[model samples]
Target: MNPQERPSWRQQSPEVQQQVRQDSEHFRKCLDYLREHSAGEHEGFYGPDSMTWVIYREPVILLGGLRAILLQIAHPAVAIGVAQNSNFRGDLLGRARRTYTAMYQLVFGGLPEAMGAAKRVHSLHSRVNGALPAGAGPQGEGRYRANDPLLQRWVLATLIDGAMEVFETFVRPLSTEEKRRFYEESRLAAAQFGLLPEQMPPTLEAFYAWYHEQLAGDALRVGDTARELAGLLFNSPFTRGQLDELLTAGLLPQRWREAYGLAWGLGQQRAWRLLKGTMRRAINLTPPTLRCVTAWHQAQMRLAQARGARPTVMARVLNTLDSYVDVPFSIRPVAAKTPAADRD
Candidate 1:
């Protein structure tokens, strides 16, 4: 469909329209918040010293990306948006890379870069809206706007939940306090990602409660679109490895695992345990130069330069992987074609 021919927020049902306005206002204030808070601090919202950066720097966290994607699409609204508005089915890896890059920018980029990343995501989401078709479960045929904070909350929640699950399972377990700190950092990013403070759970304990509730709740029904896409995703060339099955099957909530008809039994559990142990030991023995993702290396270089010190030889070598790490998303952003007067 032509961009102009797409429905506007004005044409949405009253409930969705109210949500869109609330999300717009909340995101506007979020931008203002970033502008005020992101002064001379070269380190982004969560710096190198933060638990967020520490956990996220581990390459093992990448395992959570698939888990997060599956969880996001399990929401009927998210499924409808992706099935209708995105080319994810044809280019899932590209979609995953974009998501990873945006996350890296948010976690590692300086204030301006982080804000820019947030705006870019908001811009992309601005165009993703439609109604869930019939048979999409209880909420089927309801309006869905990507900017809706409630839906955004679920997406972010899945990331938070998946990251913790993968990190603790593959890397090492986190202390109660460590988990709390990580979640606190996530709450800050949540604000930048369109959530008002009141919309987010106030504490890690509360977040856990909420996350579990959502997982078992009827709201996250895996419908036809999500199920078909997930089947393709796990079976696709990029993700057909045994490790992918282990990750997806092991990390997905039991209800969702059943909803998607993924097989898991005692044998699979043993394999998951074996794989988890093997990865943890191997990663612990690996040096930071080989352990962290390229984005961490790049961030380290940026920080060193900011402090008038050249990055160490090790960092320089690791940074070389930047071009190869997420090659599909290496291109620069295109300027928006829509004129301001014509913009939605």
Candidate 2:
């Protein structure tokens, strides 16, 4: 019998289990990719104690991810990459899945697994280059590649900056020292995508200045493709996306927000504030086990234990949700993973 259809699986909340099974295959495919492609040379990119793990595990990632996606495509090179290289518009959510899974593996998988995931991405990126739309300057001979260090920097920058924005808004503000270390550590993480140290902005201050300058100048554009992507995200078939629409707009630099046609009404501002306030308090009460990254990592360790592979990561999720991520089957999908802001 299939694992998901086993007798024990029949005992969970049928409604909940049904939803879990709906995406279990997708979850396993991502995990299986890591396990299958992992090499001995790749242990893992970051450690368990890293702040990136702490920050990323939170539900706030839902907000950060949506913000990052919107910010990335604004750059003409990234725009062209998405427009010509993939079916992002046709399968918007799938893009989110691929990006999120890749990042998750890079940050949390064993070194070999992370390397395997990175190698796959680099191979994909190497082939993805094209002409920029007429007005949006794509830098470097008017063509762009996924492997371009400059473009990689921008994409990584958006993730760090946007994730930190949501982190501060819905969680505690990091100390100056903490924030600096976070950025520096993040620069190292960005290297997993093939960035050189020199390509990265030397400091957080420099990064922000460059980021702001990009927004200030013509480094970003809302071409027909980006507009369609923005529409797909904000106007998703899921009504739950309304909050993401609001939060994503609220987080954007004002000019681009307006360009994306995302309005920031007084009502939206008040609601956004209320939402953040509520989440801050609620998240405080959340036990660590409920965090998606933590749960999945523990599950991976458990699977390793069963297979007699000494995993470097540690601990098990509280048993309640742990079984939902059964070994040799699939991990449960994180709730509201779509566009990373369905529930945000």
Candidate 3:
């Protein structure tokens, strides 16, 4: 079945507009649920003890950034939305920095901050809607809204899968229980994006079945728009891109590698294996403070201060650096909001 062939988001249609209102209402409820259940003084959706923090705090997750984006755009609707709405070609690093910052805020910031970040992203996504171009495969006539639940689900899946791949490859493998816990936490995060529980797989094993089917199926087509976006990411007038291309190509699903026309032979495979081994060794030797990202350190500092404990010297230093990068330190309480159509 062609996923993209599903009915498009039509703004003028009363049905679609009603669906949008329903989605907004659902998202607000999800936010309330999170605030009631997961929001502590300093803990966001997933606290410091969560498997999310364990896997995501590692700096190696950065290696998965491109992999996630590549997998996201493999869906034709996503590629079209990105191609139409993004300024990635003109401001790649700035775009990437903002994206990473928002992700960090969602994962590591205080409850209010995480909610604010989620609202901001949802608002921006509310504006991204367009039809696929001609010769865009079988779903050329389909329209897309970034807020579409299925599209959001696919994007979320890519992020989770990419992070899991990088963490397992360059750090250590997780047990089934560990992975299951992580997947459960991810569902909570997914709720922030307006996805209903019924829309997602109920368990980790079920998710893998769905994810593997996506990887192996023709549902993912790397079209012209996707290729253009990939070129912008992989061949910009940025840093030397050899290592970036190597890692992205090596880490992408084998089917997607072929779809994207990335060459992967014995030499590349051997090199990838050697690099993975070296990274695993290096990460094993590194101390946690050095191996973790600044956002993790900032979260630790925030929590420490809330408990009236002095943060470590390294935590203070990293907190200062994180500030320079515009990482959010706090969020004010949520105010009474207007309607989504008006506010967004």
Please give the CA lDDT of all the candidate structures.
0.75, 0.64, 0.78
Better of 2 and 3 by lDDT: 3
lDDT of 2 at 336: 18
TM-score of 2: 0.74
lDDT (tens digit, per residue) of candidate 2 on 227-292: 876776776554246787887877887887888888789988898888888988988787665545
- Please list the residue runs of candidate 3 whose C-alpha ends up more than 4 Å from where it truly belongs after superposition: 1-19, 134-141, 324-344
Off by over 4 Å in 1: 1-22, 36-40, 134-141, 320-344
Q: Where does the lowest 10-residue lDDT sum fall in candidate 2?
A: 328-337
TM-scores of all predicted structures? 0.86, 0.74, 0.87
Q: Indicate which candidate wins on TM-score.
A: 3
lDDT (10s digit) by residue, model 1, range 217-331: 8888777788887877887779987778777888888887788877788999898888888988998899866777666766777677676566766556555544445332122
Candidate 2 vs candidate 3: the TM-score winner is 3
Q: Give the root-mean-square deviation of each candidate in angstroms.
A: 7.7, 13.8, 7.9
Model 2: colliding residue pairs:
42-111, 42-112, 43-110, 43-111, 43-112, 44-110, 44-111, 62-340
**Between which residue pairs do clashes occur in model 1?**
none
Query: Residue pairs in steric clash, candidate 3?
Result: none
